[model samples]
Target: MTQTVPTPAHLVRQRYRDPQPTEPAQWNEVLRVLHEHRSVRRYLADPVSDDTLRLLISAAQSAPTSSNLQVWSVVAVRDPRRKARLAALAGDQAHILQAPVLLVWTADFARLRQLADDHDAPLEGADYLESSYVGFIDAALAAQNAVVAAESLGLGTVYLGALRNHPENVAAELNLPAQVFAVFGLLVGHPDPAEDARVKPRLPQGAVLHHETYDLAVQRAHVAEYETRIAEFYAEQQLAHSWTERVLNRLGSVASLNGRHRLRASLENHGFRLK
Candidate 1:
């Protein structure tokens, strides 16, 4: 007997757990991979090969960069002791230690700065807040490309945003130079089947996909609808808190920033003038 394949409509339904989902106009392998994405926190002992890592980097490089400045770099860390220390700095996330490889993505400007200095050229623009944003955006785009490539290759991955919680320590551990800020870390490895991670549902299309003009007032209703829909997902994950509560707790106060409240100061200390 031939195995049945899932249609685009089915995948859409699965993505939102929507009571009524319309069939998409088109579908392909890329869409399937994107729709199936999930954060795999539990990983196996198996190593990610060098060949695969190179391919992932190449894929990342293929992502478009602003003015092709390519202001991003990635450090692949595999040392157990180093990973443990970095993990400790990043909220004690066990997955950092569990994964065989941790890729630290950085917004790098030191490379260009060195070139400018060598040529005796003024690099004043690098000190601006807009330039800093460009670097961060470039790093994010590159890392996301790598994430998609890793998932396509059957490797499990999870992004460690908490790496920024203690940016200075992470910078020291990675030996990052001034003007090279660690944006985040990504853990890549073989997933543990026991974990059985599921694809997280997202907000309804009406909540985000706006038309010619934005509508702020209708967002409350959409959020209310989303809360109801996502409640099922929360129950399945054994989580008691609602999405609103979780988000609020994350951003309710300065203390909730997990030391990131001083991010501006940290950036300044790291050579980002943010002018």
Candidate 2:
């Protein structure tokens, strides 16, 4: 028997769990890949070749930089021992070990600093909080590009934000310089078929897409609609969760930050003088 394929309409509906998703006026392979994204927690032990990795990095470099500063860098880890060590520091997620490559994306300023020192130029702007944000934003944009590239190539990926749990330790493990900070880790490899991961639902566009001024009152109703639609997805995944409760619990207290509350100090230690 031939397997049935999902149409663009189905994929869009799946993306939002919308009872009636807007049919795209234009559709293509890129749209399909984007709408079908699923973060794979389980991966097969297939090695991602250096050639493929290089292509992904080139795609990442194509991402827009802030004023052409290009303040981001990445460290690719393939050694099982190093990956295991990073996995330990990053919530001990099993996918990091199972995946063939762990890309450590970093907000880097060391290169610029070296250039400034060599030319005896004053780099006072790099000491500001705005500059730190620029570096972090640059790293995130680049990493997202690489994610899209990997997914288009039929590989799987999951972003590990918990890498911030022990920022100092992660920097040490990666041998990152003082002026560089690990923003996050990305696991990339062949997805295990047994996992059967599906595209998770997101909030209704009404809640997020503002027309002009924001409407806080309308957001509650949209959240309610999201809760209702996503509940079905949660049930299908056998997950006992409520979006409201999860959001509240995740930010209820300092403890919920999981050591991330000390992020300012961690950034300073890494030479980011967020003045």
Among these predictions, the greatest lDDT belongs to 2
Top model by TM-score, which number? 2
TM-score of predicted structure 2: 0.98
Positional deviation of residue 193's Cα in model 1 after best superposition, in angstroms: 1.3
- lDDT by residue (1-275, candidate 1, tens digit) is 99888888888888898899899998899998888889999999999999999999999999989999999999999999999999999999999999999999999999999999999999999999999999999999999999999999999999998999999999999999999999999999999999989888898888898999999888898899889988998999999999999999999999988999888998999999999
The residue pairs found clashing in candidate 1 are none
What is the C-alpha lDDT profile of model 2 across 12-62, one tens digit per residue? Answer: 999899887777899999888889899999999889999999999999999
lDDT of 2: 0.94
